[model samples]
Target: MILSPSRGETCDHCLAVTVSIQDAEPWCPHCEWNLDRYEPARRPPEFGWRWIDRRTHRLAYRLTRDQFDALVADGIDRRGPALARVVTIGASLLLLVGVVLVAAFGVWLVVHDFPSLTIPFGLAALGLAVVLRPRFGRLDESAYVLDRDQTPSLFDLVDEVARAIGAPAPDVVAVNDDFNAYATSIGLRRARVLCIGLPLWGALPAQERVALLGHELAHFVNGDVRRLLLTQPAFTMLGTAADLVRPVSTFALPQSALMGWAGELLAEIVQRVLARLLFTVHVVLVAVGLRDAQRAEYLADELAAEAAGSAAAVNLLDTLLIGETMEMVVRRDARAGHGPDQWRRSSEQARTSAGPILPALRQLSLRDQASLFATHPPPGLRARMIQERTAQGPAVALDQARLERIDSELARHYDRTVRNISWGG
Candidate 1:
């Protein structure tokens, strides 16, 4: 560790240089700064150990003197280890047990034949598909670069924060009229594709844009991006099955209230019976979803702030949370009939326009959830994160006026988006 500059006084007990001699007590923080000392002392048992941050109920880091200094110097990494594999193992074991039980029972059902492990295997395969859909459903493009003229120069901003935290760069750009952005780990390679709503550039300052990028970047650096993607399909399948059979998210399966309880009890018994032969991977995944979500989000936000340097990111985040609630009339009606491309375009516009410092954002809706939530974190949590960091120590940055004017031109286009009442609303 680089030693601090020589200071006021030296310690008598140890050869440590102190930054200050304000208090009466003698404790030199650095190498022997005590001008006069009596009994020489040895270094403490734990030399350069300190707490860095927290991970899901566990203290996540142990910092040495040098590493701690490095973090503060290079800016701290916001992303941390995700306990995904932990959850994965838990789910897998549970499922394995269920598979064994199911396979055993299947054999017992036809003991003379004693050959029906196929049933359990089929269930496991189904679970695999649902669990890994995030990877499986990705576009396999070698890379998707933005059109040069259409490209936004978030490169500088994204690079600064990403380098600070050692996160991967976003590969996809959604340069449209939305305020939304998402980080997804896709394909076998787990490449991250970040989609940003174009209009936000005008509304948010350059640093604010960086902060948003940082938050999204945190998803990649943090395990949440991966966890959410990989576990999502399983989570949805198991939860939906539970809701349909036992009523976890929606109303109980069709039955009288009393009968529904009986139905749920029957379902539980059946589930347990099947579990003996089936895998609990989906069940455990379904159970731990929300807890993981909240924890991972915090780490991402903190990291984003560190990268962007202060609460400046918080301002734009706040704008999005507040302004996003409003719905405006726009011409996207031309691209109608509830398709993803249209929907993605609409969602992105609202998110970008709502930025606090945004010059403008086109009309886009933020309320659609049926297809969107599966891939992205909500904006509310991001807004709160910006607020929290600002309460502690806000990051600040300086930008050129010419660069800002470029953002302004982008803003002007949103205001002129045409309406198409001809299509269904």
Candidate 2:
């Protein structure tokens, strides 16, 4: 549904066409002005005072403020959260056990029980096991993957950053259209895939980019429970199951006779109850691992500081705080036919414009807090911690010339990414 500018409004940034679409805020489609305020209806609320969320938030804040040094001093160790790791791994094992038990029971029922009704029930149970089976992480097909051979300079920089932090370099790097970047393990071998988001990458400074790399690469060795092989599958499996089981609506129900309607209603209730249960368990798993997860994040930030310097690391966190604005600017430029060439300048301008408001935004972060279920600590807290600690200069710095060469190598990927952005892909 395309919405035309009703009031003949133009974008403040580029004087381009502006419009308000259904379930979206009024914003310029051409230059993306006012788009920062445009929240998509599809996105869920990011933070709330729900039981687990609230508890997690409180715990995160306490860790950030009261126990910051103690955690830093403790360093990365298997002993940090034994019970949490045990519970998380146990949950994953139980999921696997559940699948095997269900499949075995189904086979027994099919082989030994009455074939008429029992066979159908047995097949249904087997199908349920298949649906609930654990899955390993895999790279998204849409991602533009770059190998070391394809991007030597970029890989060299990554290798340098990994060496600086004393961590393993990613096996592969993938670029996507997301507004954020992540480092995750994939396949049975747990090969690390470093996913760099074009939107965020385009907006960051060279040193901040190095900091970003440092932070993500540090995750490889930081002992992040969620990323560990033993617990990662459980998180992936449970999260997938939770997403598959959503509240069923009455209006979506099929038409039926009176008795049939009652039976369907009972079934719907059971389904909804099961959905709620899955979601609750997922939430509990997140809550249980929240502290250790947050500790890993802070530790990663510290390592990022060591790898790229404290100033760059803190600045990177600030950039993250303004991530939404940066995304809007990048999208605006891409849609305006300005493309990647114009993104850095526009993003710099956006960052400059945000300076006055950055403090307020940081305060807002403290007041509202980050989501408890999130893997990282609050951006504001992360930045503050870096600043409060001793300052460190970059151990492995990338000169401007090398940075440009790396960009030159990634130019084609950036162009493809920008094209996708323009088409709303």
Instruction: Please tell me which predicted candidate would have the highest TM-score against the true structure.
Output: 2
Name the best candidate (by lDDT).
2
TM-score of each: 0.48, 0.76
- Name the runs in model 1 displaced over 4 angstroms: 1-85, 92-135, 139-145, 148-152, 199-202, 225-234, 240-284, 325-425
lDDT of 1 by residue, 57-155 (tens): 121111112222343345433344335445744554554455456555445555444466565655554554444333344743422344435434445
- Model 1 CA lDDT for position 257: 75
For model 1 the local lDDT of residue 296 reads: 62
**Candidate 1: residue 205 Cα off by (Å):** 3.5
Worst 10 residues of 2 by lDDT: 35-44
- List lDDT for all candidates, in order: 0.45, 0.74
